[model samples]
Target: METHTELVEGEIDLKYSLAERVKTLTPSSTLAITAKAKELKASGIDVIGLGAGEPDYNTPENILKAAAESMEAGFTKYTPAGGLPELKNAIIAKLERDQKLTYKPSEIMVGVGAKHVLYTLFQVILNPSDEVIIPIPYWVSYPEQVKLAGGTPVFIEGTKEQEYKVTAEQIRSAITEKTRALIINSPSNPTGMIYSEEELKQIADVCKEADIWVISDEIYEKLVYNNAKHVSIAQLSDDAKERTLIINGVSKSHSMTGWRIGYIAGDETIVKAMTDLASHSTSNPVTTSQYAAIEAYNGPQDAVEEMRRAFESRLKEIYPKVAAIPGFNVLRPQGAFYLLPEVREAAEKTGYTSVDDFAQALLEEANVAVIPGSGFGSPDTIRLSYATSLDLIEKAVKRIDEFVKTKWQD
Candidate 1:
């Protein structure tokens, strides 16, 4: 027997390497901070994690019961790659009921999660160097997914002066011949700012004129607060509907993050392509999850409203406290469950050079974890999710308040 080995026993071979596509992907700062907080908690520390985007609530009992029934009824086998027709009908009913819009079952594509659905969409739509316009302070995954599909992410700054929302003019200005799509996230992650109806119409007009696709991420649609409403760009016009693809799921609204069910509603061709890609990539979403989602959409929605009210209450109670933190200039968010404060002044006043450093110090010293805005393309700010209990949210804000006070240099 010949022992043929060109490498040392403990040495990694140079021939095996990760693909270049994955090389540019950045780790999610929110998950990284959440994991560190968990580590601290595991080691007997009381770490308050405001970094996670998921609701602290459990999946509603009705949904859970439905999932159990599905398994009991022998629904553990593989389902169609697109989803059960029943689930698709429920989603169709939801759109018609909520937005006065109609979609055929052929236009709905279900996947593992909203995140996965978006990844699939990008894969099917983007070609090499096609540009997608992403507004600033975006969900961390948007740009990365575009890049993964060989698309370039072109950003338009949604400065705090504009309530962290890009206008139609901004979108129009950023469009180039390479522009293939634009992503709009109302009740947006990190900021929680909902765009007005007029804003949507103007943006729809721009997309219509430019003849580009609009990817409206309405995952947070059900969580609007203080009388604010969510208007889908697709609802603006038939032309707008034709150009828009809506991505949503039960994760936030139903607290079903772990259930891993999300879907897309759009042109039949696009849905078909995504479905074919999913058949090769995921085969199908979890069988029980699809059943749970059918119940999520078709079942009574009292739990959804109750959770929304709870989040609203928490937001109202915590917003003032978070805003009162010295050097933290925060706008009162109209929707969703996060408070994004421009903290560059806070960082500078506390002798830190960057918000990222300030956030790190907060996790270590104050035992409070927050996602730095650098990950969201807003380097001067930080994102604090209020999806946790009111007590924990209050305590976390208090700790942050004291940390800034203690560290203040001027």
Candidate 2:
């Protein structure tokens, strides 16, 4: 076994640059915060964790059974580069059945996850200094992926007043000749803000006029609250569909994060290019995952609906209690399990000028771990998740309220 000391000693003059792209990477803030919380909890500290991106629900039972069946049926070999034809056909059916759009298998490319699909597209599409317009309070991975692909990220800050969604005008203003694409994650990760059909129509109009590509991350499409419908950019019009990359997965909806299955539906040319890249790269997502995902897409959706109802109930339970707190400004998240709250007001009055410090102080003092907004390109905020039990959410809100008030006074 290679010990750490021996590994460090033997790799001294290795052709590895201390100054490569990997060296320039910032670690995932969500993962870091989650780890710190776990460490503190292991030491017997009471910690409230509101930083996870996935739902609290377990993976649906039928999918697990499907995985077992796949293994039993000898589905252990690597599939086609894009995916199995059966899975691709299922994806094709899903787009038509769910989103009211049609596509062939050639227009559908599956990857390990939606993140991988987007990053692969970023590397393939973005030239040096090509710009991608990302909305503020965005996913933590967006800027990093853009930089990884050697592109510039231009962020347009959205607001609570505007329902935490970027407008077409903002998109129009942000675009330059260097702008290659825009990544829009509806039912967004940090904010849980869903773009309405009308809102998407307006944005689609702008993108069509600008002739730029849209990387629509629709992973949380099925988790909407109340009557808020998810609008796919691909469903807008022929022109809008021409340049849109529709990214979806079974992760959030089916509580299948570990399954590592996602698909991209878009222009056949781009899909083919991504498929070729993924074929040579990952070859295919896990054979079992692909099989189970087919069952997820084609299986009974009652479980998904049940989970959605639970999330909606929890959202109602948490919203008022969270709003009752003095310094925190929380908008009603439209979908997903997150809350990007403005905590800087109280932090500022208390001399904690940054959200990072506020998060650290809360973690150290109140023993609650959260992600600061600066990671998502907004400095005066923090992101919380209401994905846990109603009891936990209530307890967490009360504890947070008390902590914020007492700490601010000090």
Candidate 3:
């Protein structure tokens, strides 16, 4: 929201209009809140930030070494637009090892990150007026990416009663002739609810019957806890395999967020078109990061499990405390490093007209930052990422609890 200065007496002034696609685009709320917390911290404020979406751990040592070796070995040059063959093969091996899904190199396209890979997928497959089904309380980017592709995002509410998951019947009812695809994010961000294999089976059947694509975003596949299993919709059957596209990356798995490596696996024609688009857009993903991703998949997986264990431990320790806050109701997360609690009652009791305003008050007065659920299509709730230290999380929760206590009127 920056403003431009007026032209001087003799200077020419140019006015340009932004594209329709970007004119109404909403910036990512999670990132915006995190940035604000960092800004406060930079100004010497004692901010306890609960808005981070990335792991606090450094990238695994082996992956870092691999990236360094790739640079030293002159593998820093541009790779193929799709990605390096070796990296794609490693990704294929990962699918086979984890999900028992077979894929060839031609079917895989690596992009800057899972976010960018999704954008590329939508761009290639969507046409004007097409519709994509997005479940409620989705990751903040899904609807925006759909709209950017000239596609309409048709939302289906996933009620808290259903553990914040959309049922197959809902998907069926939401479909129409304009429906081109459906996005499924298991171990969902904000909610941390993992769809069961049976749920995925039912959903896969609906997608096959409807003859629409399923964009299965399994970026948090490796981060499940509580003995819960992660299942890919593609594994449901041959038809599901043909219709589902799996998107994932090393960022969440290997603490490689800064590495900027992610990929999509599906039909070769779709992947090829995305690759062609990327060639004209990004040229290629960072060459060293691609090489590092190869090692991330091929190297020891101990660090990945270690980080998952840490997040699980924090969730167990913090869920009760967060739920204990007056007027806040939170479901225990099955996976990922987030706790989303419905705070509408809390906001009302504390005199805030909206959850977003309550969240801003928490940042300005309570010195903690949390992403309001309005950004994730669940305005009654707020998302608190537990990716920070347990101590910081505890302190932030305490601040929020005390803030509500002080503001309570009834």
Top candidate by TM-score: 1
TM-score of each: 0.96, 0.94, 0.96
Better of 1 and 3 by lDDT: 1
Error of 3 at 409 (Å): 2.0
Query: What's the lDDT for all of these models?
Result: 0.94, 0.85, 0.93
2 versus 3: better TM-score goes to? 3
Q: CA shift at 406, candidate 2, in angstroms?
A: 1.9
C-alpha RMSD of each candidate structure in angstroms: 2.4, 2.9, 2.9
Residue by residue across 1-410, what tens digits does model 2's lDDT show? Answer: 84343456446745544756566577765666777788999999989887777888888899899999999999899898888899989888988898889888888888998888888888888888899999987888888888888888898988879877899999999989998998889989888898888888999999988889999999999989978888887788888888899998888989999989988998888888888898788888999999999999899999999999999999888888878777888888889888778887778766686778778877878788888887888788888888787777777788788887776663
Question: Candidate 2, 64: how far from true, in Å?
Answer: 0.6
lDDT of 3 by residue, 195-217 (tens): 99899999998998899999999
The CA-based lDDT of model 3 is what? 0.93
Order the candidates by lDDT, highest first — what do you get?
Answer: 1, 3, 2
- Give the Å error, residue 104, model 3: 0.7
Error of 3 at 402 (Å): 1.4
